[model samples]
Target chain A: MDASLLTIQPASPEPIYRQIVEQLRRLIAGGQLGAGDLLPSVRDVAAFHAINPMTVSRAYGMAESEGLLERLRGKGMAVAATVRPTQTQTQRLALLEPQLQALVRHARELELPADAVLRRLGRLLED
Target chain B: MNAMLKDAADRPGPPLAARDLGHGYEGATVLRGIDLDIAAGSVLGLIGRNGAGKSTLLRALLGLLEPTTGETRVFGKPALAMDDGIRQRIAYVPQQPEALAWLTVAQMFDYLGRFYPRWNHAFARDTLARWQLPANKLFGKLSPGERQRVELVRALASEPELLVLDEPAAALDPVARRELLREIALRACEAGITVVFSTHIVSDLERVASDIAFLHQGRLLLHCPVDDTKERYARLWLPARLGPHAPASTLGRRSHADGSVSVVIERDAHGRWPDEAAQPGVRLDVLGLEDLFVEIAE
Candidate 1:
C-alpha cells in the first residue's frame, strides 16, 4: 500500500493512531487494499508522516486484532489473506454518520432551515 | 555482548531521573523544581520556548552542569558522580557541537572512536555515506547542518542505551530532520534505547516522542504521554455575547475582535470536556502540540 494514502489530522479530536486505523479500514473495505498486500512497515509510515513509530505499530496491531491485517514471519504486516466481507451499503453509509452529524450541527448553528440545508447537501453530492 | 546492554535488564529504576532539579546562573534561575523520568524504551520530547530553560535542563541532566539545587541520576547513580561504566552507556549531542578546526571528519571520528570500546566504525561509515556527509572535509568548514549530522552520527555510533539530544535538528533541512527522526525511531523501537531530546520544532516532537514535557519560565509545566495530552487538554470557542465566565478548567484565554472568545481548558478526570463548551454557542476543539505549547507556555 502507498503509505502516502494515509494521512492524519493532528488537530482532529481523534487520536493519531485511531485516525490511521480508521483510514486503513476504509481502504480495506473499499478494496483499495487487497488480501496479501503488504502494508507499509511501521517505520515507513512513521517516517513519512512524522508520527511516532509506536503509534503506527499500535494502529497495525489494532487492525491485526480486528482481522484486517496479519503479521508474516520475518516479513512484517500484510493485509489478511481472508478479508471480512465488504461493508454493506448501510454500513458504508454509516461511515458518513459523523460527517452528516457535523453538517446538521452546523446547519442548526447557522439557523438554516432543513429544506435549505438539504438543498445545499443535494447540490454538493451532485458535484 | 556489549557492556551497555549486558546488565541493562538487571537495572532497577528508570534509565534517567531528575528529582526537583533546579539550576541558577549568576543569581537567575533557568530551571526550577523540574522532576523528570525517562524509561528504558521510551522517548521524551522536551519542549520550551527560547529562554525557557530547555538547554539548561538538558545540561543538568547530563551532569555537564551541577544544578544549584536538586539532583540527577543515570543508571541509578548520581549524575555528578557517574563512573565511566555508566557514562559509557550515555550519549549527548549538545545544542552547539564544538569541533577542532584542523581535523577532517574522518579524523575527528577516528579520534572519538578511540574513547569508546563499542564504537561501530562500519555503522558510522554507512550513516555518513547515507547522509551525504563528506568524510575528508574539515570539521569546522562544514555547514551547521552537516556538523549536526556528524554529531548525531558520532552519538549513534557508540550504541548508547540512553541518548540525549538538544536541538539536534534545528540546523538541518526538512529531509535531514525526517531522516534523523527515522533513525531515532528505529533505535528506540528495535533496540530499546531510551531517548530524551529537546526541540523547538513541535512537529518533530509529534513525530517520534512517546511523551512530551512542556517547560515554561523555568518551570516544568506539564509532562505526560502525548496521547493523554490530547485527551486532557482542549480549546473552546464561545460567542462573545455569552461574556467571559471563567470556568474552573480554564488555563488561558484570548478574545478576538470578531465577537468570539477562545479559551484553553483541561478535561475533567472522567474525560469530560468543560460543561459549557458542550452547550450551544460553544465549540470544543482539540489542540495539537504547537497550539498546546502556545496555550500553556505563552
Candidate 2:
C-alpha cells in the first residue's frame, strides 16, 4: 500500500496518531489496503509526516489493538487478516458525520441549493 | 488499541528508555534526573529555553557526553556501548550544519552515502532537485539556510530508524523552513521513521510535532500531547485594578493585580473563574506553545 494514503488533520481536536489510525482503518476496510500488505516502517512514516515516531507508533499500536494490522518480527507491520469491513465502515462514517455536516451546513450558508450541492457531489464522485 | 497493547506487552523488551539521566560539565550541572521513553517509530520533540540544557541532554542520549549518573538504553541495549549495527540505525544532525569545507554538495553526499547501508540515492537526487540546491556548491560557501538544508538532506537520505535533529530550521527563511518541514513530513509519512528534532520555533512544532517535551532550568517541565497542552493551558489578561493579589492556581510569568496584567494558567476545560476574576476588564486568550514555554521557563 502507498504510505501517502495516510492523511492527518492537525486542526481537528483528534490527535495526529488517532487520525492516522482512523485513516488506515478506513482504507483497510474499504479494500484500498489488503491483508498482509506491508506498511511503511515507523521512521519513514514519522519523517514523512514530520511527526515523532512515538506518535506513529501510538497510531500503529491503536490499529494493531483493533486487529487491523500486525507487526511481524524483523519485518515491518502489515494489515491484519481479521479486520471487520462493516464495523470499520460504520465507525468511519460515524466519525466523519460531524465533518460532513459542517461542510453541508457551510454550503447551505453560502446559499447553495440541494440540487447544486448534489450535482457537485455527483461530479466529485464521477471524478 | 488492544492488539497494539498486546503486541507491546508480548514484546520481550523496551525500545528506548532512559532512567535518572544526569549530566554536568566541570561541576556545572546541566541536566538532572532526566527520564524519557521512546518506542520504536515514534517522534519526540525536545523544547527548552537557551540555557535549559537541551543540547546536553541530546549529547548524553547519543553518548557523546558521559552522563554523571543513571542509565540510557536504546532498544534495550546500553546506549554508551551500542555496536555499529545499532548505531547504523540511528542518525544525528547537530545544531550547526557541519561538513568538510572543501567538499561540494554532491561530493559530500557521495562520501557520507558510503557509510549507510540504506542510503537512498534516488531520494537524495530528487530532494536535491526539489530543494533547488546546487550539487556543485562548496559546503563552506553555501548560505546558512542552504547549509542547514544540506544537513537535513544528508540525514534524511540515510534512512535511519531514529533521526535526531537539533534545530534544523533555525537558519532557514520562512519559505525554506516550511518547504524543509514539508519534505520531512513527506518522508516521515512514507517511511514511518522516528524523529526527534529540537527547535525554538513553536509554530513549526505545532505544524508537525505530535508530542512535545518542555525543558526548563535543567529539568523537564512538562511532556504531553500538543493538543492537550493547547487546550489546558491559557493566558489570562487581567486589569491592574484587580488588586495586588494574583490568582493562586495559575502559573504565570507576571501578575499585576493593581493594573492591567496577563497571567498564564493551566486549567481544566470546564474551569470556572472567581467573580472578581471575571470583571469586565479581564480577557482570556489560549496560550500557544511559545507562550507556554515562556511561562514555564520563566
Candidate 3:
C-alpha cells in the first residue's frame, strides 16, 4: 500500500502508535492489505508522515505480537502468510469489537430485540 | 543505577549533558540548576514561553555562552573548552542568523562548506532547488521564512553528528514546517543523528521528537520520552466539599470561586496515583502534551 493510504491525526488524544495499529488491523481484516503484502519500511513511514520512527516500530511490534504481521529476512515486514491461526475464533471476532459495539447500541436504542438483530445480521451475512 | 549499568569510564557519553548548569545576566537568573543527559541519536525538543531562556540554555549547552554556575559536557569534553574538531561535529542554527548577511546564499554556503569538513554540497543544492530559494539573492534580502530555510539547509548540509536549532519552524509556513520536520525525521532514522531543537509548536514535537524537555522560567520542568507523557501526570479535580483534602503541593494548582480545586499531579515511581485520587468525588484526568504544558506553565 502507498504511504499516503496511512493517515495520521497529530491532534488526537489517542497515541499515534495506537492509531497506526488500529488502521493496519482494520485494513488487514477488510482485505485491503492481503496476506503476504509487504508493508512499508519504518523509515519510509516516519519520513512520509514526519513522525518518530520509534512510534511506527512500536506499532509494528504490537502487530507482530498479535500474530497479524511477520518480518521477512532482508524484506522488512509483511502481512502474515496465513490468517492468524494461533488466535482463537473468539479472539479473531474480537477485532470487530467497535462495529459490534455500534450495532448493539443502535439496536438497543431502536428498541429491537437481540434475536431480531441477530436474524438481521444472519440475513446480511448470507447475502 | 542498575547493577548492569556500565561504569562511567566504560560507557560512551551522550552527545550533550549538563550538571547543575545555571545562567543569569544583569542580576536576573534566566536558568538554574539544570541537569540533563540527552540520549545518543534521540531527538530532544526544548519548549518554553518567550524569554524563558531557551536560547540561553541552548547557548550554554553548545558552549557559545558561559553559564554563571555549573558546567556542561559536549562530546565528552567541557563545553567552554571545545576545540575545532569537536565544534565541527555539531551544527547550531540560532533563532535569527545574522552572520554573513551581506553575502549571497551561494557565497555563504561556499564559505561554510569550506569550514565544515563533512558538508553535503549536493543536499544543500537540491533542497534549495526544491524549496525554490534563490541562491543568488543576498542572505539579508530574503524573507524571514526564506532566510530561516537557508540557515536550515546550511545546518543539515554539514551532516553534523549533533544538530541543534532554536525555534527552527518559527518563521516557516505550514508547508515549510512540515518539510523541516520530515527532514529531521529522515535524518534521525537513517543516519542516527542526535538532534535538539527548541520549539513552541507541540504538534511538530509530537511528529519528530523522541524526547521532550519542557523548560519553564529557565528550569527543566519535565524531561521524558514522548510516549510516557500521558501516563506520567494527570489533573486532579476536587469538588468544593472535597477541596479541603487536596494535596498541599502540586506542579500547578488553582482554586475556583466555587471552591473546587484543580491541581496537576504525577504518578509515583510505581505508576500509582496519590492516595487522595481514590477518595470519593475526586476525579483524575490524563492530560495531552499541550494541556500538561498549559497546566504547569500557566
Candidate 4:
C-alpha cells in the first residue's frame, strides 16, 4: 500500500488511532484492500503521516483483534487471509451511516423538505 | 547497554520528576508550585501562552536553573547534581540558537560530537545536506529557520534518551514543521526515547504527543493524555432560570449578557455528567482540544 492514501484529520475530536482503524476497516470492506494484501509498517505509516507510531500500532492491533488483519513474522501486518468480509454491502453502508444521519439532521434543522433532500442526495450520488 | 536506556527502565521513578518546583528572579516569580512526573517512553507536549514560564519550568526540570523552592529529579537523582554520565544522556535545544554563533555549522557539529561518544555524524551530515544548510557557513549567518533546523539536527544526532525541545518548529515553514514532526515521531517509536517539547502548534501536538501539559500563568492547570481532553471535558450552558443549578467545581465560568451561565465541566470518575447536565433546557457541548484550550485559557 502507498500508505499516503490513509490520511487522518488531526483537528478532529476523534482519536488519531481510532481514525486509522476506521479508515482501514472501510478500505478493507470496499475492496480497496483484500486478503493477502500487505499493509504498511507502523513506522512507515507514522513517518508518512507525521503521527505517533504507537497510534498506528494500536490501530493495527485493533484490526488484528477483530480479524481484519494478521501479523506476519518479521513482515509486519497483512490483510487476514480468512476474512471473507461478510455483509460487505451493509458494512460499507454502515460506514457512511453516521455522515448520512448528520446530513439529514442538518437538513431538518434547516426546515428542508424530505423530497428536496432526496433530490440533492440523488444528484450528489450521480456526480 | 546505553546508560540512558538502562536509567530509563531500571529507575523506580519517572525520568524527569519535579516536586513543588518554584522559581523567581529579583523577587518576581516565574513558576508557581509545580508537581510533575514525565514517564519513560512518553512524548509530553508542553503548551502555554506567552510568558507562562514554560522555559523556566523546562530549565528547572533539567537542572539548567536552580529553583527558588522545591526540587527536580532526573533519573531519580537530584537534577542539580547530574554527573557527566547523566549529562551525556540528555539533549536540549533552546528556542533560539545562540551558544555557538562563532563557529561554522560543520565545525560546531564536530566540536559537539567530541562530547557525545555515540553521536551519529552520518545523520548530521545527511540532514544538513537534505535541509540545504551550508556546512561551512557560520551558525550566526543562517536564517532563523535554518538555525533551528541545525539545532534539531544536533539534538537528534546525539541520540540522547531524554530529548527536550523548546518550540522546535517555531521558525519552520509548514512543510518543514511536518518533516520535523515525522522525525520526532520516528525517534520516539523506534528508540523509545522520552521527549518533552513545547509547541504553539496544537495540531502537531494532537498528532504526535501522547500527553499534554497546559500551563496557565505559571500554573499547571491540566495534564492528561491528549485524547482525554476531547472525551472528558465539555461546555455546559445553563439558562438564567437555572443559574443557581450550575456546578460549583466547573472551570471558566462566565455569565453572558443574556443572563445565562457557561462553564467548562468534566465527566465524573464514573464517566457521568454533572447532575445539572440532566436538567431540561440545559445544553452540553463536547469540546475539542483547541476549543477546550480557548474556553479555559480565555
Candidate 5:
C-alpha cells in the first residue's frame, strides 16, 4: 500500500494510533486489503507518517491481539480471517449504527436525495 | 535451557521489540545489545544525560541509522523492511526541525501532502492558523518555537498510529509546552497512540508519560510504569543516632552522618518508619520523576 493512500485526521480528538487502526479496519472490511496481505513494518509506517514506531507498533499489537491480523515469525503481518459475527460484533456494530445514521441524516439535511446518497455510498464502497 | 525458553515463550511479546540493536561512532559504541519493549498504547519516556544515546536509540528505531548488530520490529514486523504502505501508518517528529528548512511553511505542507494520500488539508490549515504560523514564511526564517509548531503540525496532521517525538517541545515556551502536552495526552487517551518521547527535562515526562525507561551509560538502568516508581520510592530523612551505624535495609546508600542523614527509599508502603535513630527524627517524602532522576543519575 502506498503511504499516500492513508489519510490522517488530527482534529478528531482520536489518538493517532486508534485512527490508524480504525482506518486499517475499514480498509480491510471494505476489501481494499485482504487476508494474506502484508502490512508495512512499524518503523516504515512511523517514518513515512513522521510519527513514532512505538505508536504504530501499539496499533498493530492491538490489532493482532484483537485477531484482526496474524503475526508470522519472520514474515510480516497479514490480515486475519474474516471476523466472526459474535455477540460482541453485533453489539459493536449496533453502537456504530448511530454514527452512520448521523452521517445519513447530515446528508439528508444537505438536501441530497436518496439516489444521490446511495450513489455516493456506492462510490465510496467501490473505492 | 528448554525450560527457560518455555517460560519466556509463555510470556507476552514485547510491545516494541529491538534485537541486538547496535550503533556507534568511529570505534566507540553508542548503543549495544539494546532490547526493549514498551506495552501497547502506553507512554514511554526515554531519559539520559548529554551524549548517553537517547537520540541514537530513537534514530535506530526509525531506521535512520543502520544498526551494527541486530534488528527492530514495531509490533512484530522488521523495521528495516517496512514498506511504504506501512510507513503511512506511523509518525515521527525529530528533535530538530531542520529537515525542511528550504521550503516555506506553505510549501512544506504542499510538499508533505504529496506523500500521504490521506493528508487532511483542512486540519493542516486550521493547525497552521492556530499556531499563527505564516504560510508565506520560509521554514528557516521561523523562530525555534515556530519551527517546533511546524513539526507538531506535520506530525499531528498525519494522524499517525505511533508518535515518536524527540524533545518535541524543547523550543516551546511554558504555555505552548503545556498546551502541546495536553494535546498529546488527549490523543493518547482517545486514540490509543503509543508515544515514545525523549527529554532531558524531568517535568515534561512527569506531566504526560505513564512509563519511563532510564538510559544511563548507554544502558537501560530501569524501565517501569510511573505509578510503580511513585508508589515504591520515598525520600528518607534519618536523624543521626543508633551509635553512628546506618541501617542496612535502605534502597539507597547511607548518607554521611552530618546532623541529619537523608536517603531515598525504593520500597516504602507504610507511613511509619522504625524509631531506632538517635534523635527519632525520621520523615518520608514522596519522590517524583525529577527527584528520582537526580538520585539515579547520582
Candidate 6:
C-alpha cells in the first residue's frame, strides 16, 4: 500500500486519529491495501502528517479492535488476512457511502431529479 | 509539609500541575491566576502574542521563578524545592538556548550527558547525524537553528519524563521544525513523555498538540483539546447591522468598511452554534489555528 494514501485534513472538524482510521479503512476495503500489506509505522505517519503519534496509535488500535489490522511483534501493523467476510460486499461499498451521501444530498439541494442524479452516477462509474 | 508529602506518596497525580499560579515583576503583574494540569503522555502547545507571559508561566512551572501567589508542583512536590531525583526527571529547552561558545558540540554533549542517569549517547549521536549538525564545530560557530537542534538532541537524549520547551522552534527552519515535531511525537508515543512546549508557530501546534492553551492579557483564555477547539470556534461573516445579535460568547470582532462584520465565537460544548449564526445572512467558516490566533489576539 502506498503510505501516501493516508492523508489528513487539519481544518476539518474530524479528529486527526479518526481521519487516520477512516482513511486506512477505505484503503483496505478498496483493495489498495491487501491482506498482510504492511501499514506504515505510526511514527512515519505521525511525522508526515505532523500529528500526534498517539492519534495515529489510537487509529491503529481502533482498526486492530475492529479486526481490520493485526499487530506483528517487531513488524508493526499489517492488514488482517481476513476482515468481515460476512459483510464483504457491504463493507467494500460502505467505504463510498459518505461520498455518495454528499453527492445525493447536493443533487437534492440543487433540486435535480433522483433519476438525473442516478444517471450521472452511472456515467461516472462508466468513466 | 510532611502531611502533603505523605498524601502525594499515597496518591500520585499528574506529572506537573499549577494552581492559581501568579507572578509579577517589580509590582507589575505579568502572570495572574494561571492554572494548569499536564497529563502524562500528552503534548500541550502554549501560544500567545509577544510578552503574553508564556515565558513567565513556564519559568514558574519549572520552579525557576518564584510565584508571587499560588504554587506549582511537580510530581506533587513543591516545584521550588524539587529534589535532585525530581529535577533529573525534567528537562527544559529555553526560548533562546545558550551554550558554551568555546566548547565543541561533542564536548558539550559529553558535559551534559554526565548529569543524566538515562542519557543515551547513541541517540544523541544519531540525531546529530540525521540533522547534519557538525559535532566537531565549536558551539559558537553553529547557526541559531543548529544550536537549537543541539539543545533538542541534549534534551531528548536524557529521556526525561517531563520536558518543557519554551519557543523551541523559534530558530528552526521549516524542515527542521518538522523534524523537531516528529522527534517529539516519537518520544511521546514510545516513552509516554509529558511535553509542554510553547511556540508562536500555530501550524506546528496544530500538528502535534493534543491540547492547546491560549494565553491572552496575562490569563489563559482557552485550554482544550485541539479537535474541540477546531470544532467549537469559528469565524462568522454577517452584515454589520446584525452585529448586536452576535453570540454572547463572541471572542473577538472586526468591522469591515464594506458594512460587513467578522466575529469569532465558540459553539457550546454540544458543538452547536448560536441561532444567530444559522440566520439567513450569516456565513460561518471554520478557522485553522493561525486564523483563530489572529481573531483572538485582535
What TM-scores result for chain A when each predicted structure is judged separately against the true chain A?
0.71, 0.66, 0.71, 0.71, 0.65, 0.70
Residue A17 shift from truth in candidate 5, angstroms: 24
lDDT of model 4 at position B86: 79
lDDT (0 to 1) per candidate: 0.83, 0.73, 0.85, 0.86, 0.70, 0.82
lDDT score, candidate 2, position A37: 86
lDDT of 6 by residue, A41-118 (tens): 887887677679877888899999988999988998998988533446767787778678767555643557889888
Reference-based TM-score of each model: 0.88, 0.63, 0.86, 0.88, 0.60, 0.81
lDDT of 3 at A110: 54
* CAPRI rating of model 5: incorrect
Writing each residue's lDDT as its tens digit, candidate 2 over B182-221 gives 6556555555556777888776787577678888778877
Which is the winner by lDDT between candidate 1 and candidate 4?
4
Q: Which model scores highest in DockQ?
A: 4
All candidates in order of DockQ, best leading: 4, 1, 6, 3, 2, 5
> What ranges in model 4 sit over 4 Å off?
A86-127, B1-13
Model 5 segments more than 4 A misplaced:
A1-127, B1-15, B237-263, B268-283
Q: Give residue B232's lDDT in candidate 4 (0 to 100).
A: 84
- Comparing 2 with 4 on lDDT, the higher-scoring candidate is 4
Candidate number with the higher lDDT (2 or 3): 3
Better of 3 and 5 by lDDT: 3
- The candidates' DockQ values read 0.42, 0.12, 0.30, 0.44, 0.01, 0.34
Residue A5 displacement (Å), model 1: 4.6
Two-chain DockQ for model 1: 0.42
Lowest summed lDDT over 10 consecutive residues: which window, candidate 4 chain A? A102-111
After aligning candidate 1 to the native by TM-score, how far in Å is the CA of A119 from where it should be?
7.7
**Model 2 spans with C-alpha error above 4 angstroms:** A1-127, B1-16, B137-144, B236-253, B257-263, B267-284
Q: Candidate 6, DockQ to 2 decimals? A: 0.34
lDDT of 4 by residue, B47-146 (tens): 8888999998999999999999999999788999998887887899888778789999999999999999779999999988877889999999998878
lDDT of 3 by residue, B1-298 (tens): 2321232235356789999999999999999999999987799989888988899999999889989999999877899998887788789999888878899999999999999977899999999988889999999999877888898899999988789999998877788789989988888877777899999998888778999999999889889988777767888888898898997655789888999998988888998988987775577776778888888888
